[model samples]
Target: MAGIDLSLKEMMAIDGALGAAVVDYSSGMALGTLGGSKELDLAVASAGNTEVVRGKMRTIEQLNLKEGIDDILITLTRQYHIIMPLTGRKGGGLFLYLALDRERANLALARHRLKAVEEAIAV
Candidate 1:
């Protein structure tokens, strides 16, 4: 397994990756972050997205879908935000948040890379 630092570095290697962060949804805090521009406040984004994840999870429970969330995707005019919640016992309630330049990123590849990052990331 990769350490958190290395895993975040790998995530930034993805083409068009604007920034990436390992965030704790419960606390709305970023444990590690890389590659954000002035326009992208990784910490603020992390906290805001935390609410998004929590809201969705609560909705799922209310609906009684009996399903687990894999990830949440938010597409903007210029960027793509990908929120991937970790699943293993050690990773529950934590997630990897990635931002990409829509014009330069390949969404499919980014998704695949994020999944690999999640698997390798050691809490």
Candidate 2:
């Protein structure tokens, strides 16, 4: 296994983590997943989130922004959804998706940890 393959496991260790997945934005596919309850279909969420990443990428291009997206955070009444695109040379067009319980999550720490996880993912 790639040294970075443990990313999903590390993500699950985060406080309040409800679900986590590595996504292929170009294909709308969840490469790997952990923690989502049955009622919370990770497959569907991963597919839907592809659009979110695409929309943001489009917006940045249209604005001619020089900066790439570090992450995108969606705050719901009870959940926090984070979308982070990967930066690895072999991992273009991929992202890390995390769902957290707002009441129990430390958003700043979770973001920090997610960044770390992104750096470690090999593909």
> Per-residue CA lDDT of candidate 1, range 1-123, in tens?
887799899999999999999999989999999989799999999999999999999999999998988899999999999999998886867999999999999999999999999888888
Candidate 1 overall Cα lDDT vs. reference? Answer: 0.93
RMSD of each: 0.7, 1.6
Tens digit of per-residue lDDT, candidate 2, span 1-123: 243348999998999999999999999999999989986689999999999999999999999999888999999999999999987585679999999999999999999999989887887
lDDT of each: 0.93, 0.91
- Candidate 2 overall Cα lDDT vs. reference? 0.91
Badly placed stretches (over 4 Å) of model 2 are 1-5
Off by over 4 Å in 1: none
In angstroms, how far off is 60's CA in candidate 2?
Answer: 0.8
Question: What range of 10 consecutive residues in model 2 has the weakest lDDT sum?
Answer: 1-10
Please provide the root mean square deviation of candidate 1 (C-alpha atoms, Å): 0.7
